[model samples]
Structures are given as C-alpha cells and as structure tokens.
Target: MRLQIGPNIDNGRVRLDFRKSPDRPQSTPSYEIEQTKADEFVKKYNSQEKKLFNMTMIFVAAFSMLGWITSIYKRSILWGILGIPGGVIAGLGVGAMISSNKKNNLMDKYNVKEVTKN
Candidate 1:
C-alpha cells in the first residue's frame, strides 16, 4: 500500500492517495480522502516549514553578527570573512535536523506511510 499526502499537480490542492499496490501507475489512485483532512495536514506542514525557514534565517543573522563582532574585537579579517559561510552552514544543518524530526512526527500523527508486499 502507498499513501501520499501532498499537493496535487493539476490544481495545487492537498490530496491524499492510498493505493493497494505500490507498483500501480500514478494515474490510478485507489482511495482518496476528503479535502478537509488533507487540507489540515498540508496547513500544518506548511506552517512548520515556514517556521523552520524563519528560525534558520534568525540563526544565520545571529551567527553573522557574532562573527563580525568577534572579528572586530580580535582585529582579524579572517573571522569576518568566514562568518557568512559559517553561519549558512550552521543554520542549514540545524534547520535540516529540526525539520526532519518535525516531519517525522507529523507523518506519524497523520498515519501516512507506504507498505510494500514482500
């Protein structure tokens, strides 16, 4: 069985697809859920994603500022130059980790998964 919870390509509405066989073509979706339920899931997901992105940007800004201040205090150009990329890398890493956990939790809550016959 395969379960999909995301936007539909045709109308951009959140859709839930449940298929008895994983090998079935995309054109055929065995079961479809109500719009309200799918919409709720999509709204939660999008909100979480937005929050993640905002937090990441905040981290980047904070790190960059901290680096700049340190460079000024230490009188080292290297610190200032390294700040931007360092901030970006750190922010992305942190964001990705948090995002993964949140998505997993959300999926679990919604009981969305794929099962294959062995």
Candidate 2:
C-alpha cells in the first residue's frame, strides 16, 4: 500500500507504504496440496462476493424507503410516484458499482483472477 498526501515532489511525496519482507516457510508444500488450497480460495472468494453484494443491496433498499417517506410527507403525489422507482434504481445502481469495486479489490489483494462463466 502507498499513500501520496501532498504534491509529487519526490515520487508523489509518499506518506506511508507497507511491504512484507520475504520469509521462507519451514515445511515445503507439495504440488497437489498447493493446488487444493488455490481451489478453496476461489470458492471462498465467490461466496464472500455474493454476501457483500446482498448486504449492499439491502442497505440501498432501506435508503429508498426513507426517500419514499419524505416524498409522501411533502404532499407531492406526482413526485412521489416518480421518485420512488427512480430513487430505488439509482440507489441500487450505485450500490452495485461500489460492491463490484470492493470485490475487485479483494481479488487483487489475493492475486486471484476471476474465472469468467459463459
């Protein structure tokens, strides 16, 4: 991780960066076992991705409920009718974008490439 707080005087004036030093493992892993671990990691990542997406979606739905209430309180029938669906769609769209970004970050951190399905 790297952070550039100010101007790019010397490589963007890095404020903080963390790196792990190389350390050898005590026991050497067999080829078959390493492959199994990689498979498990993918399964975990996929399951976690679905969970995060659902959480974000429910949060947006709650926000839409609040907007709907406000529209009704203001006595704007037409606006309420239009705004409800509009707000829900917008909120969900934003949520999807944020969730996707987070998922990508997780994949990058784990150095795992997502397998595309047809």
Candidate 3:
C-alpha cells in the first residue's frame, strides 16, 4: 500500500493518490479478506441508511399533516392550509438530496474490488 499526496504546483491544487498497486495481491489469507469484508459491510450500511432516510421522511410528512390537522381543529385555517404540504415537500426534497449525495460518496469510497475471474 502506498500513500501519496502532492500539489500540482502549476495548477495550485492538491492531488491525492492512495492507490494499491496493480500488481498487488487480489486476495490474501487475512488482510485482503478483511478489506473485502469491510467493503461488504459498508454496502450494507449504505443500504440501511437509505431505507431509514425514506422511513424518516415519511414520518416527517405524517407529522406535518398532523400539525395541520390540529391547526384546523383549532379553527386556524390559513396555517392548516399552507404549512402542511409545504413543510413535507421541502423536507423530503432536501433530505433526499443530501442523503443521496452522502450515500453515493460512501459507496464510492469503500467499494474497491480489484479482481475478476474471466
């Protein structure tokens, strides 16, 4: 394993290359096996995160609707009419975007498979 970090002096931007050499072993008795296991675990974790994010958004929408209903029960028509779907839509849109970006990043960073049987 090699770690290299440098700046492209001409471009004034930092570059990082933490690459395992192409000639490196595709599998090993222990270390490589552990890395593969870790990749699997990260995949599972990202999946669970996506599911939980969906569920939470559903609950938030329900809660917003419940709030609107309570307002209507109290005879506050304007807030009941405007706040419910607005909050729900905004919450879902923002949450979905943020969660999607983070999950993609996690998957990209951890899923490193270097071998395939032909």
TM-score per candidate, chains pooled: 0.58, 0.55, 0.40
TM-score of 2: 0.55
Better of 1 and 2 by lDDT: 1
The best candidate by lDDT is 1
Model 1 quality (TM-score):
0.58
Q: Tens-digit lDDT track for model 1 on 1-118?
A: 3355644434333456543565776665322334556666656766676777787778777767776777778887797788667767877777778777887788677754433332
Q: In candidate 3, which residue ranges exceed 4 Å CA deviation?
A: 1-42, 62-75, 111-118
Those runs of model 2 whose alpha carbons end farther than 4 Å from true positions after fitting are 1-37, 113-118
Index of the highest-TM-score prediction: 1
- lDDT (CA) per prediction: 0.62, 0.53, 0.52
Candidate 3: residue 87 lDDT (0-100): 66
Error of 1 at 36 (Å): 8.9
Query: Candidate 2 on 1-118: residue-level lDDT in tens?
Result: 1111211223222111112224533432211112323445445545676677787778678768877887888889887887678778877887888877875675466554322221
State in Å the error of residue 93, model 3.
Answer: 1.5
Q: For model 3, what is the error of residue 81's alpha carbon versus the real structure, in angstroms, after optimal superposition?
A: 0.7
Residue 20 of candidate 3: its Cα lDDT?
Answer: 58
Model 1 superposed RMSD (Cα): 9.1
1-118 in candidate 3: lDDT tens per residue?
Answer: 3323323322233332334577656642111112324546444644566575776687668767766777777777787786687667766766777766775565466542322221
